[model samples]
Target: MKITHYCLSALLLFAVAGCDRLEQDMLSVPDDTTLDRYGLDTLKLGDKRAEVGKQLDALLDKPMQCTPGKTGLGDKRKAYLLEECSGVPVAGEVGKLWGEKLSFFKAVFVEDQLCSLELQLKTSGDYAALYEAHGKKIINLFGKPDEANAKGVRWQREGDEAVLKDLGDGNISFEIRNKKVVQALHHKG
Candidate 1:
């Protein structure tokens, strides 16, 4: 199913805990991995990494997950570290897109059953409108990307099993979920 910007925003989440799924992966650490990485003085109900990933999993079950950072929409700047890797446009790397300059917003991850990755972004305009132009191809190199070539719709990329969705908004968020790309239900907001 096709993923829309509005649908992508709802699942935007910040990673803060360690889930069991990480155990299978080499990067998977202990339950307190998040605390070690980000330094958590206090843990809240929603502050658990594993739990957060689970909640985010349900949120992003289709459309994949996109980590879009740094936007020029209207007149704001943002950056997403993890999500930033995908929006660069060169297939890999995030910094400058040849002749294009940009800032970053937030980084979010959208996953699927197979654990594929998709980065989502909400952008307006950038230095060269670089993102305003070829953002999908950039995200395409990250994972599964779909180019939303429709006018006024922005862009999107679907990788082997993941997808990066551009909502055309101005905020980007990523969450860890058991599955990736949550299916879209409606097109219009």
Candidate 2:
């Protein structure tokens, strides 16, 4: 009886310890190159609309309403916009990307899955400087862009693509898209 009791206690202790380690591993930050190709912190390219909404609920001034005909890609997209919602303030990993300069953020869903994320950054007189600063940060995370030019930079990996461009209107546009979803939309149209 004593041996059985001691063995059970030891097994329970080992199980608890293992669970702790697993939890820590799950919560730890991912490596720079392992952000699942293209994601804005917690928001990923293929997340469901409900999950994305739950994650961003605090930063949104009001509940995001899915609107039609906003994507201009086709009639099958539903878009949620945070236009001028910068007043609400953002925090965490998503906020660190562009910080207070972020003027707009849009998430487009195809068949209830997030297909794209678009962000607009409002700049002052020195758009170039702002673009360079943000560009460097993106490069550090995703490495050298596959395509680069005076106006923009693009990085493609697997089925995902990230583009950062100078809008030439005191704004910078950064977009991340899932190629498969986008291609399907175009094909349907």
Candidate 3:
């Protein structure tokens, strides 16, 4: 059993490497100009990231908000995103950078005139604790993502709601939210 696990792990590593190359190809699909428009640096979260105070404003905005589209790519997807994304991103999605559905995240966004986006992570135990531990820092960053590297930081605009798009590849647009994912877009992926 130990040998089997080790072999599997090695295979997984190789697979990840191959997938990384493929992702690079996919990302290259969008030229630098287009990516710049989307704001995915993949190197650093530039100065356009969302702020916590701003997130509060979006959440408290005087209009109805929700997940916006469909729900539960599967029972697992629904559960996975709900665990990490509770109230912030109107769109809900969870997965690793490769964009598989296993409850991992790296970025988030808050709506408003700025439409700030930030990074996020999966938490264990309590949501409040998770928020305090990582959420606060993400909010303070107040920057946007680098899409040239496949990092989902699609800059901001007031009422410019966030959305998750899986380019039909392992790579995905992980929508990191400032607060709980109070709403989500209801569509099948």
lDDT of each: 0.27, 0.53, 0.29
lDDT of 3 by residue, 77-120 (tens): 55222111223333343322212222322233223111223323
TM-score of each: 0.21, 0.57, 0.22
lDDT for predicted candidate 2 compared with the true structure: 0.53
Overall local distance difference test of candidate 3: 0.29
lDDT for each residue of candidate 2 in 20-92, tens digit (9 for 90 to 100): 3323332452454665667765677778777776665544444444554333244446443212112233442
Q: How far is each candidate from the true structure, as Cα RMSD in Å?
A: 18.7, 17.0, 17.8
TM-score ranking of the models = 2, 3, 1
lDDT of 2 at 168: 61
